[model samples]
Target: MNQAFRDLFGAKVAGAVASAKALGQVDHSGLKGALREVLVRSLLRPFLPPSIGVGHGIVISAYDDQSTEQDIVIFNRASLPCILIDEESGLFPLESTLFTIEVKSRLNATELEKTHEKAARLEKLRHTPGETTPEHVIPCLFAFETDLVQKTDLHRYQELIGTSDPSIREICVVGQGRWFWTPQGWHHTPPTDTYSEVAGLIDGISSVYERVQATRSRPLLLNYVD
Candidate 1:
């Protein structure tokens, strides 16, 4: 079962990467980026439980602060339906959001720093008062390629990790390796195979979903009322 799961997503990941590269020859970077995001959304939807909705959107707090457009916003559709701004985008309430992901065609130090900053801003968005939800939204960074040297770049990665919000859960660069956070500290898992990197990410998402399921109760949406 595990191998089948890995094989399925691994092929999807390869296909997405191939399609993105084919599109990269075009002059428009935005088109390529958007295609990558769409491909990633397709890969995730089939694997996630039906109750967990996925889309591209901006997450808004009750106070009206909003996250920048997220590449992938995973939320509890069964509990609270997000407002659809359009076919490809929507407005997800902070309390309804499980997590947000920023996808990149390439991962570099500058891009990683920017993602960290974005995650920090997301950490500031307060949920509806007294709502039964995760205290912080998990922020994840996913990239198809990376520019950092595996050995010499360790310090740079560590420095960013040292200062990032604790809610920033995972950074995955497919074909490279992944960095994940735990109560003990950050840990690195070198890529063991083409499929393992993405498989690790799916596993991480499942873990978060399971944890939320164990702790989450019916959210008190009434708390949003004045």
Candidate 2:
């Protein structure tokens, strides 16, 4: 808002980024991944309505197969046949999940490829009762920074991943930009500033919140298998 607050906010973001980079050098650990995931989950959960929750879980099939562990799961936990939990982790019904997200402190081609693979697995899982394709569940990838995908390289990456898995619908590289697909196709909004990126990131998710809620199907005529 004010120049003083802007400067303070910039300094804070820089500090957080520096901390994440330092954690990255420590090797494979939650220290590196959890920071981003927790921040994103906390920031995003409130933007969604009270009916939705943000947490970690997997989508499951009727036969008991499961999707890979999601970094964040936005779901309607109140819905029966949607969530089941045990000593380890929770499982979410594909129909009840509004979206799944993978968060990275930094994104690279390797991480990007792995993210796609996970998405493919989720795409293959069957939906709850009346639901069809996993296209209703938005796939998203978020990063604090990146060494992988970029504007100059986006075309090639898009071509490389073509028609393989359901593609990520929203990509927000904090302090960088937000990329998303629409009826008009792929659109990229380059970062204006850290504040704008933060705004855009939340706003991008907010749009999905509105969209999924708007188009959500009501399960009628339930014939309980149990």
Candidate 3:
């Protein structure tokens, strides 16, 4: 912790600390933006390699020309999701691994398409001349607050994941609800609600981020539905 921040948080910090500690234990339905961000950072920070870095609320350049930016892009997704670019340490550069995360209160096809375009465009830029190419395939993490993804809708999502590059991993976090992660060519049992299930989902999502730098696993699916 920075000295300046610590000084400011002295004495009265215990309350905030307590609240923060309780976040992971809280149900997803009760998750707020602050709490979710805290949880993700806490879980991801530990697994990161010292060489790689992490930031919060950072900008992700999607195209070589800087035409698009995202909430966060780990390395580069100009060509493949979760791929990291060594040229420049931002999204849209060559050889950079990118992880595109979508945290929505709810999701729709339109939103999904937009996210896909962002990832694809970044992938295209990775190889373009004068544009940095990310080395890693970007991964996708979708966290939501809902129960039960519609059967037809599940098929659409499965198709999207199938079309993505093999390096990319897709994980969905559904808060305090019930859902399933069924990609085409694979069958996953429907999720059921239970104690610690939501926390497990969050943990799995964090695991992906921690291991993203070294894995070629298919998009790992994490459904946290009631």
Model 3 whole-model lDDT (C-alpha atoms): 0.42
The lDDT per prediction is 0.74, 0.67, 0.42
What does the lDDT come to for candidate 1?
0.74
- Estimated TM-score for each candidate: 0.86, 0.77, 0.46
Q: How many backbone clashes does candidate 3 have?
A: 51
Q: How do the residues 1-226 of candidate 2 rate in per-residue lDDT, one tens digit apiece? A: 6888667655655666677777778877776676767666656765667777777778765556678999888876555445447422477766567788898887777888788788777777655444432346788887778774445324534865875433677777776667777777777777765556655666776666656645545453252233
Off by over 4 Å in 3: 1-39, 46-50, 56-67, 75-94, 127-135, 147-149, 158-169, 175-226
Q: If both were scored by lDDT, which would come out higher, candidate 2 or candidate 3? A: 2
Candidate 3, residues 1-226, lDDT tens digits: the string is 3656445433222333345445536666446445654444444445445444443332323332432455434442322333234432343333333354444434566766666666555445423223332234454545443334554334555676675542224545443332223244422323333213333434444555445434332221121011
- How does residue 45 of candidate 1 score in lDDT? 81
Q: Identify the leading candidate in terms of lDDT.
A: 1
> In candidate 1, how many Å is residue 222 off?
5.7
Candidate 1's C-alpha runs over 4 A off are 1-6, 131-133, 150-155, 161-167, 213-226
Worst 10 residues of 3 by lDDT: 217-226
- Give the per-residue lDDT of model 1 (tens digit) for 4-53: 76677677889987886677677787897788888778777877888888
